[model samples]
Every structure is written in C-alpha cells, then in structure tokens.
Target: MASIEKLPMLAAGYEKLTAELRALRDERPLIVDAIEEARAHGDLSENAEYHSAKERQGQVEAAIADLEDRVSRAQIIDPTTLSGDKIIFGATVTLLDDDDKPVRYQIVGPYEADAKAGKISYNSPLGRALIGKRVGDEMEVSVPAGERFYAVEKIEFI
Candidate 1:
C-alpha cells in the first residue's frame, strides 16, 4: 500500500477546515436546485444561467473534494498541549532584535502559515532559522528586505 501522507497543522486550523467543508456540503443542494431550475428555463446550449450554474456546481464539488482530502490526511497537533525548551513544530517563539524589539512567531505547517498573523511555516527561511533554537541563541536570517538578526528570548507551546 502507498504511504499515508500526513500534514501537520494546529487544532484551530483543522477546525477551520472542518467548518469550510461543512459549509461546502451544505451548499451542494442549493447548487443542484439552481441547475434544475436553470434547465427548466430553456435549451441548455443557449442558456447562460444553466451554464453558470453548472460551472458553479463543478467549482463547489472541487472545493469540497480538496478540503476533504486535506482534512483526511491531516495530523492535527495542538500546540497548547506540547511542551519543550527548544523551538520545534507548534512552538510559539519570542525573539529580541538588536534594538530590543520583540517579535513573536508560531511555527506551523505551510497550509496554516499566515505571515501577517505571525504564524510561520516550518519550510520558511525564518522558521528554519528558529528551529531547534533554545533561549539566548542568536541567529541571522536573510529576508527579502535584508539580513536580520534576533536572539531567542522564550519558547512557549501556547
């Protein structure tokens, strides 16, 4: 049998996907009804509404399938339940720069990584630099803007 690939993500991220999947499932009947109604209007070849509804149905089905695949293969890991001294997957790390400014980031899977929200993916440059780092360990990271330096100040599971 082929290996069952696992994708790690936080509990909240998994919950979000579940909610999206549920919404997509709920929308299926509405799309079906639309298609039926559109078909009743006239010849399908000339009907724009029918074509649009059919296209929408296809899109919705595709989204549902993708979300289901991701969720089924997910290996959910709740950061709050994890504890470690060194930065690792699901660890929220706090770092201080040369200017004494603090920046916080949580290492997560690529699917759940939102840089704006300070959740960095393990595959990212900064995340790779921070991995396995303990408190007081300093490292320089090369970002798009320039090279930045930071010292690990704290690591928390939450």
Candidate 2:
C-alpha cells in the first residue's frame, strides 16, 4: 500500500481552493445546459458549438477533480502560531542579496506560490535551501536565470 501525500497550506490557501471548487461545481449545471442547447442544433459530427461545449466540459471536470484531490489532502497551517529560530514552512523570511538588498518571501504550498507576490513554494530551490536556516545564514540556489546567493537576515512567523 502507498501512503497518501499530504499537501500543507495556509488557511487562506485552503479557503481559496474550496471557494474555487464551489465555483466549479456551480458551473456544472451551466455546462450541462450548454451541451443540451448545442445538441438541439443537430449534426453532432460537424457542430462546432457542440464540440466546443464538450471540450469545455472535459476541461472543467478535470480541473474539478484536481482541485478536489488537493483539497482533500490539504493540511491547513497558521503562520502566526509557529515560532522558531530556523526557517520552516509558513515562515516569512527576509534575505539580503549579494548587493545587500533585502527581499522578503513567505514559504507556502505549491498551489499558493506566486513569485511576484513574494510567496514561494516550500519545494522551490531557494525555499528548500532556506529551510532549517537561522538568521545570518548564507545559502546559494540555482535558478533558471542563474546561481543566486542570499543571507538570511530575519525570520518571522507572521
């Protein structure tokens, strides 16, 4: 038997997934209606509307299944409840680049990661390197752009 993989996420991330699942569920009825309306137009073989609706239905169902799986495995975590000197998931870390410029990032689950938003997945190269690091620790990570180095300046659970 294989063990189930758990997805760790913040409360907000879990809520976001559930909300999207609800929206997708709500869209199911509309998709069925669209299929019925397209079928009424006849000629299923060459009917563009029917084919398009069917493709959309497939995509939506696939998305719903993926979201459901992720939601089912979700382990909600609160950052504010965590406290430690070492970097860990849900830690908001501040690092100084080679130029001594400070960059802040919050370690989160893969689904909640948004680089532009300063949220990084715990599995990312940089995030992985930062894990278990304490203040003033230096680490290097290889990204698609190039190799980058950073020094841990601070870690907060907020």
Candidate 3:
C-alpha cells in the first residue's frame, strides 16, 4: 500500500498546478519531435542538439514526477466550508503587534505560501502561533530575531 500524506491547497493553487502539468504533458509531442530531428543530424558523439533534447526529456520527466506526487497528496480544504471564530487553516487573521501596529495575514498551506501576497503557510512560525487563537487573544512567538508579542484583533474566513 502506497500511503500519501495529505497536502493542503486552495482551489486556485490547485488549478494553477494542474494547468502547469497539462502544459508539460502537451509539450511531450514537441520534445519527441525535437529528439527525432536531432537524431537525424548524425554523429551522436558531438551532437549538441541531441544532448540538449535528452537533457530536456530528463527535465520534463522529473517535473512530471514531482507534479504527480503533489497531486496525489493533495487534500483540498475549502475556506467557505469552515465556520469558526478561532484561527485555523484558510482563515484570514488580523493581529496587533506589541507596538500597536496592525498586520493582516492568511494562513494557507505550504504549496500556497506567498508572503508578498499576505498568505503564510500554516507550518510557518508566525502561522503556527496564530492557530487556535481567537479575537482579543494575546500570544507571544519566538522568532529568529527574538520573542515578539501579538494580540489577535480579528479573524475572518475569506
């Protein structure tokens, strides 16, 4: 029995990966054509085209394997299905740091992590600290810089 760990992902994230996999699969014919053309050029020992084509084939196969592994382990969790007041996966949270400055972030899976977009992975230090917290809850997180305190201002599922 091959057991796969459940990978969490947002619908958009899942769709994006699916599209990438589809594009890779669609490029298979072009890769085959390139290999055939390269082989016709003769002298196998010094053929750059042939070597490049083989390298491309290896890259494509590796990508396919990685994508398959991700898809197999995926456990899609819809944000809309959640009904909770406490912070949990897919929940957008607003926190006030010790300085009284507000920072907003959404807890998502590793696959959907995009710090620039305000999406943090649940496994991250900050995200882990925010989990199970409710509005008005004060918590301290130990980061590389030092220990920082934050108060949960709001929790929303979006």
Candidate 4:
C-alpha cells in the first residue's frame, strides 16, 4: 500500500535517509540509558539532564518516523536506464544562453537537488521549462532575476 503512490526520490537520497534512520534507531539504547541515569540522579521537579534526554528522545523518534516514511514512499530510478533526446527526470542537459554562455544541469528529484552541484529539481522553474525539450529547442525560464532564454544543446541520461 505504501508503494501505491510512488514518490520520486533519487536513489542516493533514499540510501542516505535509510542510513540516517538506522543510526537513529541505534541511538535508542543510549537515550534510554541517559533517561534512566538522569531519573536516578534527582527529583522529577528539578532535573535538567532528564528533560534534555527526554527532548532528545522525542527528536530522535520523530526523525526515525519521518525517515521511515520517506524511504517507504521512495521510487528509485537509475539515470542510466534512460535513453532519450527529450529532457526528463534524471536527465543531464546542456544549454547555451542568449548571451552564448554555456550552462549544464541535471534534472533530479527534490531531495537530491543541489543547485551548487548543478542538479535541479524537476519541479523547479528551469527544470520545468527544460522538460520535453530536445536539442536545438529554445525556451525561456522565469527566475528571481528575470526571464532567461536558453537553447538546448545536449541531453544525456547518463
């Protein structure tokens, strides 16, 4: 049932989230020990360590729950499994701006999108504009700066 509505998440992102969830689960014993030790130290009314441990426990549990849900809902796709001229999810594209400046970007899922790494989320403005476009296609994307024009130079699903 959790797999019915597939969530588009990068394979790497899914692996990272599952690893984090495992680490959080491993911290259960430590959190329990901290709480028990704190409780043994003093009264319920004035216990800083106890309160801190309880808060940390709540945070860890919440993170575990969220990560589990995300990992369960993720639908992983390998970029190499694709072969198309048109831009789509996991497609790396090269573009030439109106000013002749060259730019490259890989359209990826939201969780794995890192602008600094030249990875853009498919839901992003530029990514949306690039979708369904092939080499030699011209398009304009509206960004915070302004509308920018680009000509698709290449598409790679590597």
Return the top candidate by lDDT. Answer: 2
Candidate 1 RMSD computed on C-alpha atoms after optimal superposition onto the true structure = 1.6
**In candidate 1, which residue pairs clash?**
none
How would you encode candidate 4's per-residue C-alpha lDDT over 2-119 as one tens digit per residue? Answer: 5365668678878887888899999999999999999999796799999999999999999988888778888898889999778989899999997989899999888789989999
Better of 1 and 3 by lDDT: 1
Model 1 CA deviation exceeding 4 Å by range: none
Each model's TM-score, in the order given?
0.90, 0.98, 0.89, 0.88
lDDT of all predictions, in order shown?
Answer: 0.93, 0.96, 0.90, 0.89
lDDT of 1 by residue, 46-132 (tens): 999989989999999999999999999999998888887899999999999768899999999988899999999998999999999
Residue 133, candidate 1: alpha-carbon lDDT: 94
Clashes within 3 Å, all models in order: 0, 0, 0, 0
Task: Specify the poorest-scoring 10-residue window by lDDT in model 1.
Answer: 77-86
1-158 per-residue lDDT for model 2 (tens digits): 99999999999999999999999999999999999999999889999999999999999999999999999999999999999899999999999997999999999999999999999999999989999999999988999989999999999999
Q: After superposition, how far is residue 76 of candidate 4 from its true place, in Å?
A: 1.0
Give the lDDT of residue 125 in candidate 4.
93
Span of ten consecutive residues with least summed lDDT in model 4: 1-10
lDDT of 4: 0.89
Ranking by TM-score: 2, 1, 3, 4
